[model samples]
Target: MRAGGFLIPVLLVLAGCKPEPEAPALALHPVPVQQRLPAQVSAPALESGRVSIRGDDALADVLSWTLPEASIEQPARARAAARRALAKGDLFETAESAIPLLLALRKAQPDNAQDARLLEKARAALLAQAWIALDAGEDLASLRYAQRHGTVLRTLWPALPEAKTYLDAVDRAGQAFELCVGGERALHAGNLDTSGGALELFRRAQALWPLQTRAQRGIAAVQAALLAGAQAQAAEGDFEGAYAELSRAGRVRSDAEAIATARQRIEATRTDRIRRLGDEGLMALADPAGLQIARERLAEILRIALPGSGAGVALRQRIDLVGHYGLFRPGQVFTDEMADGGRGPALSVLPRGGFSMGAPEDEEGASPDEQPQHPVRFERGFAMTRHEITVGQFRRFVTATGATPRATQRGHSLAYDARSGNFLRGSGIDWQSGYDGRPAGEDMPVIHVTARDAEAYAAWLSEQTGVHYRLPSEAEFEYALRAGGQTLYPWGVGAPPAGAGNLAGGKDVSTRGRSWSNAFPGYGDGWWGPAPVGRFAANAYGLYDMVGNVSEWVADCWHRGYRRAPSNGQAWVNPGCRTRMYRGSSWASAPAQARSAWRASGGVDATNARVGFRLVRQL
Candidate 1:
């Protein structure tokens, strides 16, 4: 009888409850056609029976809603009978009930005071009945019962404040009904946990009318479906999918014991599957050639197992330790035994650590290509040759494989022309040539070798030493060049410490008495060309000649910048690339080129004196 317990005189208008004006003369003017508009709040889904005033229950019937034919056409007689019916507690339930009968009488004689009084009495009875239904329970059926009475009052007499209140309540019931029905349809369509699925629909319905039986059942049914789906998913060894389904179920009822029970079941199944996968991975790891298969198994276990699970973590560690060719420690100096009863190049096990790989924008000599610095980490210890590979190492590849390098096959290579202060193609120059186109010492870093030549030497060394060997990735080169130094320069933010390595210097003059126009001030290595390998001091990582050496080809394609660069120290390469990256500064490189992040590229088939490469072995 009130809007949220406060009398609201104008609430009916807000609810769209404007009734027709009462007639002043005692004559039955038929109800207007517009006033007989069909009711929007149909009660077809309610249990109170066919409840439209349109007088037809056919599915497609669209006739206007109206009161029953005026029974007892005599106004005075109808008024007395309605009073008797009201005293007997007969209300809107029956055609002859006091509310409907009196409404018809008032229509025939709109100014009859006695009939109007009697109708108000019947409305009071109707309100009492609706209150009883409202207080009956929060179940869907009881709510619908109350809505049925509200519908009757709103249609025939909507001026009362109570009609607006009950009208709003009935509208909510209609919404709840629609939502529950949609939930049922989604359940049948197998849309369990997706957006707008059964779970979402049912939970929304419950919110509108808490514990309304139909909505409650819809929620329970969705939860059950989710739990069953989780079990089936786990049975198929898809533990992640199972956990996903269980999580969906928990959203429906977080404290439901069934969720915890299903989670436990899924966990047991997942643990067993992870153990079985670990065993298979271990078996694969036992084979000398099964590392790839073991890696695949490790990937699967990580997907299903919780983070840091013992089985998953242990298997990963074992896989990483498989190819420990030297069993060396970080910063440990060691060499693998070669098949020829010799030894591989001296190597320093670079420590496993992280470093900012590219130059910061604030660094004076930093270029746009080095903007957006990114971090790189080495997860496993790797062995990098302490210095560039020498002419002697490459000579062994040429003789054993009969592989003629590009420079040799072409009968010439790029060599520094001292007289012109430029590099020009030279005759009869090859990997065995020096920076001056003369026969090079075996200890000098090999010159006039293409990237393919470097890679070929690595392959030959791998066969000889029975260990993996390849050109270091650009990230690895930069990491070693930095050598735990985050300064702008490899040797710190000043001139390269004297005799640091072979670098273009202000104090050094060429054989023709030419000095570097853009060289480090107050510094010179006293060499007009690349010095013999490791001629200078080792970096903090205990590797020699990293900051200043012949610029070396690394195993990466020439990408424009650090965008989408690899975070780990792996090579970011593109297959069949024509331009490959070279890192570290050469003896001819300027001070700007000596920054740890500086890099350059040459054609894959390009061979020159200023560029050489070193080998890195897997540990």
Candidate 2:
């Protein structure tokens, strides 16, 4: 009993741990046996007059049972039935089976004139059917019928006038049918032009047979093709072309749903195009050149009227604002002769803004003095001369002020010697004489003038014109030189582009006696000494000779580096400041020295052939 008790406890534990047994699998029932019945054969006879044409067996039975008896005994009655069938346009029965029966009648009754007349009627009926088929554009079927009719008519009556005339008509109709077929093919091929294309061919077909269905179908196909083409053009952003195509399609099928949908799509595309143009115009407001392009784009949009169009009004307001703010207008200039009866320098209005004062650190060959690039802002706009002060302009100043320039008082000036290939102080050379010791041209930039002399000229100009004329500050000089760019040079990061400005290009080597050894490599500007003012292309601000030809005097005192430069673009002047600052490289300077950020310090009284200046009038 104790052993049994232990076994029971172990069985209980095992039962708890084990999984339950799966349910019994489904059982399949046995298939029932089918019994076969004895076969029985019974044939049903076809009706006496009815026949089945469903298969060869049925057709053969009918032909054997019915054709022979009727064809032999009642040949005349067979001919009459075939004639009646032909008259009813039942050509399949009349031509395929009845024709043979009618031939048998003619042979059996060789002297019967009715048999010949019935054969002629059959041929005439076929000719009529051929004409009908030609009108329907069934060229293959029509041609087959025409040839069969011709063969039968020729065999029976070799010179039948009616047959010949019918055949001639069939030939003419065949031509028209072929043209209609070609029109349909061209329409399927997507040639839907109104003139000299598929549509014209369709119209010609209609003109030949006014009630032809093939021509009508060809016209409908062309209309559908035009609508489809319009939809494709609209998808490709050609709204005007799409609209024109849709209008043509409307003329063809005014009630077509696709035509209406295509017109709606064209309208939507045009509206979207106008909106895009307006957005582009608004985006261009920040740049002068882009703004002009924007104006053109917006004008185009206005040319095509849109519902609720505000693009033109908005663009006009933006343009007006730009004009009111005295923004730089390309090619706009102000010119007036000075009091001394000499033509004054042309001046271009400059916009007031902030710009970086020096070159960036990564710029190639950048100097340390141009470090700490900082922003300098101008509070008001100004107008600066488009070209440097010319010799004639300085002469007028001298004639009015009765002033003696430093170079003139010195009795000699530094001049380039072409024969010796070197620069030397030449006797009897002064401001009136050029850098080559020749009489200066009236249009050439005046040279060998001290900063004080330039200041005196500005003072005389301000007094004569009753305007605030002065030398541009160092910040203003660099700002105007840069124009609107941040490159190492005014143009861009590469070596100065050809004809940008007159630097120490090799153009002077043969004419001026000497060429800069470290000049911009491989550059030749075509001028040795300073070129006539405005010879080179102007900068973005419409100022010429800002970087080369001559270093220009500014109103700043020399402070080495821009350690604490003025942020407001004012001149950094101090009391008794002996050393004044000049910006830009001279004709004798290397390419790197001609950069917009390059700075040179000279005594206020210093004069040389490489130094000159331009003036500005505050507005």
Candidate 3:
């Protein structure tokens, strides 16, 4: 007989043979030992019938896995007979031959209960083996073994703590086995979804056994094949394919390091390929001297416009903007301002290098109108209004230049209400409402202003201060918001764990509620009125109220879509019409409406309690 005749016959029998009639199952009874030892002793009775060398060879293969360096004695003649029986597919004879040794196990135990308990454990192990085999797609063999083992476990279930575990494992294995067979049929008949579902079950089964070398390798191989297909698609210029492949890889393996590596490689490959295809190109510096001059001018503007601001906060904002938009390097700043209802002598200055820009797509109230998103790119930088033009500040300008006030109230700011002629709160006034919504106050933001009024203020300030101040282009507003990173919010995505912003008033107004309406705590959702500006944590850029206080008016006029939008960081003002852009959001809006990318618009004259403005300058 060949060296592996015993194993070869067993394997061939298992491959095609049907199960035999069930016999009374034998139990495993452990030997009683006076002292603990590293290894277990075989039962003497079974040892006598073990066919010595043939049995030893068979047991050796199984034991080697658990104890790599082991030696055993074998009787050549007895081994030869055992090997011949195995070669002839005589499993019954082989199994019967081992029973003598098994009986000795029963004798070794002191009591019938102990013998019974050990036998139950042995039965459970067989059940577990059935389960493992089923998962490996060995349906017939696993089912036969499971039926045999399960019968023994059911009889002994009351005596074993592990009986339930073995039962459950067997059930899971049965389910997986069914799926695998069904999946093979589905694949043959071209039912991709059904086939895929079964494959997924197989993958899941493999994952459950972290230490199963065969299962682990099988999973990895399947995943690698899928990724390879995706890579091919990506190579053919299918960006969607590439993304899908990477996403699949992520599902297969959630290792952070692996995911990151794949991400980097994917990006590098795509970028290189895109460049080769000439789909995009880099901008070369046009004039070094002009760029330097712009830089210096921007620095000077920042020195004046952002004086006394915390360095940490401002620097952080700048870094965020640069990273998100890839618009400018860290520390760039640019300013634009609006004034006097579009009555300008507008001053434009370069905001110094490094400013945050752009909002993410998912912010509250963000709409499709805000997409086709990219970074803000300002060729030059300058100074911007530290605060929205205040009633007092505008009043000072009026006083300095002798410009007539729209409303001639001594202390009462002239605001028009639809019902009342002059309202104190600017309740119903358009953006052009005079007196800056307060009586000569230099610190209060100029309210009730239209886009035109904002532009007028910018022009007036430029003429008086010799510094060009203008409304920040839409791009500039985003840049300022980002400040220093690619965060979802000016602060960061998700609600800050600490209560910070003034929305419906909670850690996260959008996410805090039990339901949509219940999301915010302490405050009703957009049902309550608006609050004053600077009412929440300032973003890293030193800008306050970028979200949920009041929506700030932006330089861009309304366009339903981003088609033909400018890429130079300037406001897209061509064929511009009645509607104007607003960013951030207000108390009256839902949390979704307060996202960084959120946008709103109304007629040029439209004004609301939650509408406000900030100014920027370029030098």
Candidate 4:
């Protein structure tokens, strides 16, 4: 007994020192395997749907110490997580999280009828949220949710037939939205096939939902855009543009208003094509000779049909003005009237003859070609303008012959100053101002005539006077100035003597006068503008202003070189009259231009304030 007592004490001490069996680890790192009710009625489905959680246990077990009512807070935490996913457009995550809480609710209260209804509502809400995600351009999230939840819903749908119908409708709406979204994406990427396919599906959805306002508008807008594109292609000459347009038009609903509008638009397009064809036909036949006729016809058509179309109207007017007045034609001419009506005893025999033409090589104003002097012989004679016809003379011609002046005359004329190249509205001279810059007189030369107008006046004179009145051939003009002599000028082989002619007032200054004294050069008078045509000594032929005053018109087409020029005194009429020749010089021009051999050409239709003319005829 004494030994047993000792052993018992030693055993007790040994047991106490043997780490106390670790006291079950003092429950410090203890984990209780307490039964965990599901977090909600649908926790199992949520877990199956792959919703990852921290631990595979009741949520209450993990957080029971933190909350007095851990079971109640469990549903709230699950809902919060689901809400977070939904807000991020994560449809799959939202549905997965929500399902667990639903399962937990069902598990914790299987006998409650309301639990089943709650689960159904939760499932429906998840589906609707998935549709929302699809609408938000989240295609991957939408597909994930639809694949997982759709199977469940479809299976659950049969039991709740009404819910099945709702889910089906939601699915259809989502599909329509997806097709439209896909079409826009493809269009952005320039993939025609994908975009067209999606657009067609979008149209089908519109048909399926006949009462949906947004769907109808969407379909209408696409149809209109498609038609516009096809029309643009048609304008670019694509024949298939018509078929594309028709296809787009066919997509419109068969309502009377829409059908009628489409038909009207189609008819309008055909009309535009007809008009364009006519214009192209005209342009195809465009040429210089027939330009006038073509322009008149086009103007008449537009005036009668397209009066309000701005471009068409402008083109129509432009064609008429440019073509009719811009070119010359055969049998056109001009003439002078005072010579026929007044003092020289009606010397209507306007003789034309060629002479040794060109200025002398030693002359101050001579050009090189004017040096290799040549002779030109006129086989015929033309009647010429007697004393340069005055402005009053032309007014009388206009009144007696009922001829229309080429340019419109008005009381208010354009006031132009070449010094500044500026214009303003001022009325210093009347339209009838004579070439001499004096008031209207019977003997002064006419002024303010375009070359075309002068030609027309000459033609009118020819008809009225019963003689062929026209401009002198260039050879005849120079011959008359020299009077059959090849001298430097009509007077002698030197510059003009004082009082011999009107020119710049100094020897060096050939364009303007410098001092107030009249002893500058030829004219000796400080006349800044034209004097009367007879104010200076006449040439050997008794013609006036061969070198100054106003230049004369000659009947040769302007050409740059005489390489292939005709040797006879006749007009050059080839190439359809691109330019008209002007001989002699104007008051505003330098004396160099006044040289007998100097020749220049200008547009036949252009008129200048400084330009005027004398006419000639065949005798």
| Model 3 C-alpha lDDT per residue in residues 488-587, reported as the tens digit of each score | 5556666533434556543222222322342344444232333344545665555665666556788788887665676656676533267888776555
Q: Put down candidate 1 lDDT per residue, 507-533, tens digits, no spaces.
A: 989999999899988787778988888
Candidate 4: list runs displaced more than 4 Å: 1-353, 359-373, 401-431, 434-442, 507-526, 574-578
Clashes of 3: 84
Compared with the true structure, model 4 gives a TM-score of: 0.41
Prediction 1 global C-alpha lDDT: 0.73
Q: For candidate 2, lDDT tens digit of each residue in 165-283?
A: 44444433333355565565455445566456667876765654454555666666666666666766765556667778778877864567867776786677666566545434543
Highest lDDT, which number?
A: 1
Number of backbone collisions per candidate: 0, 1, 84, 26
Q: Write the per-residue lDDT of candidate 4 for residues 1-619, one digit (tens) a residue.
A: 0111123322232231221000010010111121112244211111011111122333222222210111334655555654454444443322344454555556666775655665565666766763453344223234333334434454434345444543443344333334444444332332322336534645644443333333444444444444444544544444355446546556644445654565455545544553443333233223333355545556544533433554244335434454343232222233334444742112233233556556545667676645455666654343444345566657766776776554344333333343443333334443365432235455555655666567667666655654345566676667666655665555554556666555555543323323323323444443445666567766655566666666666667776645456556555544337578877665555656655677777676544445567765433
Ranking of models by lDDT:
1, 2, 4, 3
Ranking 1 against 2 by TM-score, winner = 1
What local lDDT score does residue 7 receive in model 4, on the 0 to 100 scale? 31
Quick one: how many clashes does candidate 1 have?
0
Local error of candidate 4 at residue 615 (angstroms): 1.7
